[model samples]
Target chain A: MKRKITLKQIAKELDVSISTVSKALRNSVEISEDTRLKVQAFAKLYNYRPNNIALSLKNRKSNTIGIIIPEIVHHFFSKVITGIELVANKRGYNVIVGLSNESFDKEVINMQMLANGSIDGFILSIAKETLQQQDYHHFKETINQGMPIVMFDRVINEIPCDKVIVDDVRGSRKAVEKLINNGCKTIGIITTKDYVSVGKLRTQGYLEALEDHKIEAESSLILKVDDKLLSENHLESLENEISNLFETNPKIDGIFAVNELYAVTAIKVARKFGLEIPKSLQVISFTDGVLSKHSMPSLTTVSQHGQKIGEKAADLLINRLEQEEAIEEGEEVFETVVIETELIERESTK
Target chain B: MKRKITLKQIAKELDVSISTVSKALRNSVEISEDTRLKVQAFAKLYNYRPNNIALSLKNRKSNTIGIIIPEIVHHFFSKVITGIELVANKRGYNVIVGLSNESFDKEVINMQMLANGSIDGFILSIAKETLQQQDYHHFKETINQGMPIVMFDRVINEIPCDKVIVDDVRGSRKAVEKLINNGCKTIGIITTKDYVSVGKLRTQGYLEALEDHKIEAESSLILKVDDKLLSENHLESLENEISNLFETNPKIDGIFAVNELYAVTAIKVARKFGLEIPKSLQVISFTDGVLSKHSMPSLTTVSQHGQKIGEKAADLLINRLEQEEAIEEGEEVFETVVIETELIERESTK
Candidate 1:
């Protein structure tokens, strides 16, 4: 309430060195009992708070982490942010969030802004554009500067860092196996772009599973939609694509949409064609969301365990940050944390 | 290549003031052209960077805003956050996110942490627990300390601040009016705890609409679920509640769920009872999410324009921060923006 007090003033009042006062204020064990007690009392009297940034400069640890997310509007990424914050906050680390807006340039700039002593490390999910570009020199630069990074979903394979990812491939494979088990032989795959590592992995897993079930993977049955084709006018293009796929391969009895949005779209397209779900065209999808639960037949899906993925990713990054000194040389593969994707059989697959 | 140089060190070497160097570094037009050129040459030569945090402190503006969201995993809040970030980032403000995890204490602690010069101001949606408690003295304290707060969605009526909110009452009323127009006499409501301001407003709006249509509002038709019930055994309790509501009020031909989750649940329960959506019982809900889009009949909803709300809130706060003087005194109302809701007529209501 009175004049603002500084560590120098406290040091003078206590007749001790500035470092000793600073150390005592930080609760350092190096300060003696009497000095610590006096310094603590004086600090309490003045309500002294050491400048965090200045202290960080001296210690060379910012105690802050930067997080780059593709989009906060997405439920999956938002859950991941929650997980990261829970762990980071518990460990007394502040988190700075930057949105890439699915742009590579934005993502790079976001990383560059905090690369110099602003943040100790980074935890990120790559933007769709960044995945498409496949240039990870910005991440590499941070690694060269001895900063730890932990990547979650939508990660790049080229960058060497600690990674926390869901077993998308395995999850997709399991979905295909389930479809085959349910007497669905000709499965139609509805997906948007193969640019992402996750997308590629999911597609490959689908193919592998089909092969294992003695079903030849047909390229014509794969109905691919570009990311740009989600707009209003693009709906016609999507409808045409679906119609063409059906025309070419009329035996398709099952459909698997890689993402939930596309899955819902698949359901709509199927309905337009007067396809009776489960009876005529069984529907299965990757990544569970609100839409899947509400879809006409209440979509059967391979749940990605979004919350778990987020929690695990946060745990991995915080764990690495805590053990920064003893961190290993190579990339820490977090087991691809294959949290089993449960088949939530609702009306769609019944 | 030699040693990393700082702004202060460079200022000393060039015999120029630190303020001048800082202004030049930012390319501020306040400095002379020759001096600015010299500062730029030296800064580039030595790779000098003034500490962003320290500079921010000196200017009394951090170019950062603290955002406390209840839960980002929810689509509505996630969309709101995305909107806030889009506007804030474009205006050159970094957003620091904190998840309240729906706890009052955690929310209070986050407010306290950011109050002490950590961020320029705060943008928040009250936690569910906070709404239930209705205590906002901590927020008042921050405001008293000259920190601006812009609250969106879940906001307290008592707190005098800039607020961005959806017209829940009006939206609900219009929804019921539409149901009435569709030939529904008896309407039931499924909602979260009535303690939240939004929930109460929606219920009131429903009552108003029912009265307007000459339909009697019955207490037996309302089902209120608390947080504990929500976290543990929601589906079972909700299912039981819906069955009981229908049994007691068998004449009920319409249902209004105050949120997307409840709306989705209503669709599931309706299907179990062999009731055709929109044909036998017209259904409408608030808070458009992935679930609503995927619900069996594809729900007709009172879409709370979260993106618009978020953008408006961010703009309000940024405007206040950018202007040297206060914009307005006493609760700056953002005019409860009522974005039109579309009735997505699918199998349920069509």
Candidate 2:
């Protein structure tokens, strides 16, 4: 769908910073008269619509921060929420949560419900359905109406806002490299469909590591799991798919799964195939969940530090909310923070 | 804290139901004029304050439900929240969550923040600290101010409102009975301090089960872990405590732990003592969490069915809220629903 040019785009065309374009469009006293007039003319030419940030800021502050997550029964999201709660409570701000359940409509409804004078700003992770649809009109409308949003984990590059994200590519690359250093020849990856940004990045990292070691990437060794298997009700199907991967590739020696459920399921399937873990089959997954620590042979994992991501996201949002209060209307600068992931080795890998 | 007599107390004194007293106090058309005068005179004599239900209901509806959980990183609570979200969304209501982190002060603050006209009703589980302190003024104030509350899991029996709770005593008794039937002698129990109502009831059930089976209840076999060990940061201390339990009672062949964390820790400690699971030692836990399902020797658990509990609580709260709308002022009737627990047999038990 065609959309109006954003402040970032207007600034890029006029060879100025986004802040300058914003000030010029709003006719701020800080902007030089010549640059202001030129920027305004260019913005008009492109039919740019100014964000009503000032109008939102004028509304009564709720002293509460809203967080919308994709799932509530997930450990990673839970840890992030705990971290946000800790920071929010300490800073005299209360935290409230909304679950999108990975639906685009729910995400939009949740945001509108909380943003309707219930919270000062938002700290959220994008829903999988939203990412897949590529429809960000609701998010755009909220931002345009002057409400600030700080996104974490799953974010859109096109949405100009503060974001905190894990280095998924580097994290998964390290997991694959660890398997390589342990002398595993046949490496397999169990991941989600490419629409999930993290899964896509992790898949990319697995390919890059194989390329770095001059190993040929084979389609037969990779399994893109259908998300329906994640419901835990269809864990049998997930196991069957993994079993198929092993059956098709008898030489499979190493595995990297994107999440805990997939990693543990892979282990169960490997054991059924009479393969001893860390001896014949080495495995690693990206998320450090409880299942990874307590599984039969345990699992090696890339720790995304969900708590740190939440803390950083909360800090960024609260800082912006407070800064806007102090400076009234100033230059709008957004920051994208990349949180480093760590590899935690356990019995799964040799 | 000294408090004003409630409608419940007046009803109890006058040998009438709580709803009758509530109706009479409000001088409702449904109540007989004589009964209304008698109830009103008694209320005046006792300095009773009528709940501001009408005033609260008169305000614009937020169409949002507020849920305050003691902890956010718990699997049971997470499942419960998922159930609440499922029902709330379908009923055209949005759900928001607040974490008290088991702190009384935080619980009060969360209630106050959400109660400030942000939500129509609340569904909460009591915090550990609030239970310890026995300070219920916050809850009383909210109820008095006329917002409906639905409580689940950890709830106060004294609080008169809708409640959905697992049959803790019966559930724990069944868990103990399972060990007895498994042909294991010298059964041990890992539980929490008695300040927590659930823990107290669970301990009582343990004693009752032993008595019913003609086995002597040994005080030495019971280990009440400090609440601090639940932080996960102090997991080492929890393991050490379980280790000491085994070292001092080497004859302990069976164990019933109140929660998944304690049960998993027991398994780890037993392994260190060179005891194989379900071979020499059998264990059963109350909560069926992720740890129980994925542990090396998967645990046998009495499932509390948290999601079912949440769904019930949501239905009860929403029903009352909607019912109130039909009748401008009506008799208030509260309910307590008990969700049954099921025993899931796994590798940990014979």
Candidate 3:
């Protein structure tokens, strides 16, 4: 087998120090441009490439960002990751992914494991349980150790770091207001994440929208479903819950489902109960998935642009890393970007 | 900030050479167990973590794997990723993802970018275009460079690497036989990926099932919907094609959709024509997404066990990596695991 060419071979041929050859390849200003070009030409001829590990060792930066997401099945997080990868790749960095499965302990352990110089920085969407428990010391310790972090989506406001978030409250409020303007009176809300900050904010928006229109917020109309019930046996509990929802409120004129799955279920359940969509119940939901665009009535949704969110978060982290000057040690709040939530009126809501 | 303790600090305090301290930390067999314990204890006390990049340089292993997926928004790929992350995390490996977006050029570029010592191995599910083109050179080069490759789901038969795949042929066959048993004489197969290997196999299965039931395979009943129409906002084209499908085969009593999204559309189109599910037109599909489980008259589908496929692929890759001796230079074909896809009797096909 032919031996692979090493940086030492280029150095030996050039009659220069190995460090000089390395510097030239890196296009370091310390090396003369003529010498750099000469070294680069020779390296190219021999197909000589410096070991990335060796380079990372000398620099103490891997040019890689670690991203931990709770789940990737959802369209919102998936687009966010695509956006992050797009920016990270363009900026000459790689992204490593860790799935927390929405476990707080797993999130902490992942952070601790990646903290040992595996990446230059971290861009994370905290798990649901992590936000609920308020256990953010692991993230705090990482920041304290001089590692930069940028949190997105399910983030804890308490942790002092750069944060890029969707204005969930505003988006929800806008959704509710739009439904109200379309003459939906008794708007019923379905949310699985009542404990998490984003979920709470969205619910708050629902209440605020109701108050803005002088409609009383009824506790009975607010449905709080847990993740366990959602995951167990293919929507058996969800079907039952939807059945009860209709049974309890035959007079309900509109529905606002917080997630795509719930919106789909609402559409299905409403259809089964002989409620004519748009005419009987105007449905508007959060987090558009494939189902929303293809359901029987072809759902109306508030599309959370996942790709844009991911891109913004990556840009923030990469920018911070590239900036040579030390940033002030405090929570840097990135304005919660409200990507326009276009109410996609389809057969269900038209 | 206080200077963090380094390897130099531990070595100086222990009166040991830096190399010996490093070796001891690695629990090298050359070092006595007493020295190992002492080094570990001191390292723990000082929180001395050997730089990850430095260790990678010495070992020539990144402990990071590159995962190239077609798209994350899809349920099968997302769930498979969840399973892969589960195993990869346990084994102390981090995965970096690259989206191929179902483009051959993108897949090739992703392979080229990761080939330069960025990852220890590559785990991929080939893009539809890649399969259609029958391209294997990009994959071949990675293997030649001694980088392990594991392909899953939409895999190539010729690629000499570890693979994880579900028996699409058998699954489709089973679905058809079940529909036939339900007393449906005329069946329509909806597929967008007629060029890929999996699509071909599944189509064959459908034909075989028809032949077994002594039903003629009618060319007109085989709806070859364009792949781009499935994902793109070309709803009009799809609606026209779906309308044409029903028109071509007015006696089409059952529909077997190759994917869940298409199946959901079939349900929608059928409803637009005022056809009742199961009683008038039975429907079944593959890759159980939320749409399948939650659609009105909830769909019956052939469940592709994504997590199991992921687990199998990871196990195969790790087994090869950990083998005491060098691997033989031919494709190690892990049996195409035929995870039995049961007929999920639901409201639609009941």
Q: What are the models' TM-scores?
A: 0.87, 0.80, 0.90
Candidate achieving higher TM-score, 2 or 3: 3
* Candidate numbers sorted by TM-score from highest down: 3, 1, 2
lDDT of 2 at B271: 84
- Ranked candidates (DockQ, high to low): 3, 1, 2
Q: What is the lDDT of residue A174 in candidate 2?
A: 92
* lDDT for residue B24 in candidate 3, whole number 0-100: 93
Task: List model 1 lDDT by residue over A289-350, tens digit each.
Answer: 66676556767888877767766766766676667656555454443444566767776785
CAPRI classification of candidate 1: acceptable
Query: What does chain B score (TM) in every candidate?
Result: 0.88, 0.82, 0.89
Rank list by lDDT: 2, 3, 1
Second chain TM-score for model 3: 0.89
**All candidates: TM-score of chain A:** 0.85, 0.82, 0.90
Question: Which candidate has the highest DockQ of all?
Answer: 3
lDDT tens readout by residue for model 3, A1-350: 12246778888989999899989998999999999999999988766655666667777777889999888877788888889988898888888888887888988888777777778889998888877777788887787677778888877767777778777888899889988998988999988666777778889989999999999999889887766423666476786888788889888989988888888888778878998888889998888767777766777887777788889889888888876336554444444444555566676675
Clash count per candidate: 13, 0, 2
Q: In candidate 1, what are the lDDT values of residues B228-287, reduced to their tens digit?
A: 534557667877877887788878888988987777677777777777777888889888
Per-residue lDDT tens digits of candidate 3, residues B1-350? 22246788888999988888888988899899998899999999866666666666777777777899988878888888887887887888777888888889988878777767667788899887777788788897777667778888777767677777878889999998989998898999987657766777788889999999889999888877777534556666776788889887888889998888778778878877777898999999977877787777788988987877777777667666666136555554444444556567787785
Off by over 4 Å in 2: A1-59, A229-233, A326-331, B1-60, B229-233, B325-331
The DockQ for candidate 3, computed on C-alphas, is 0.47
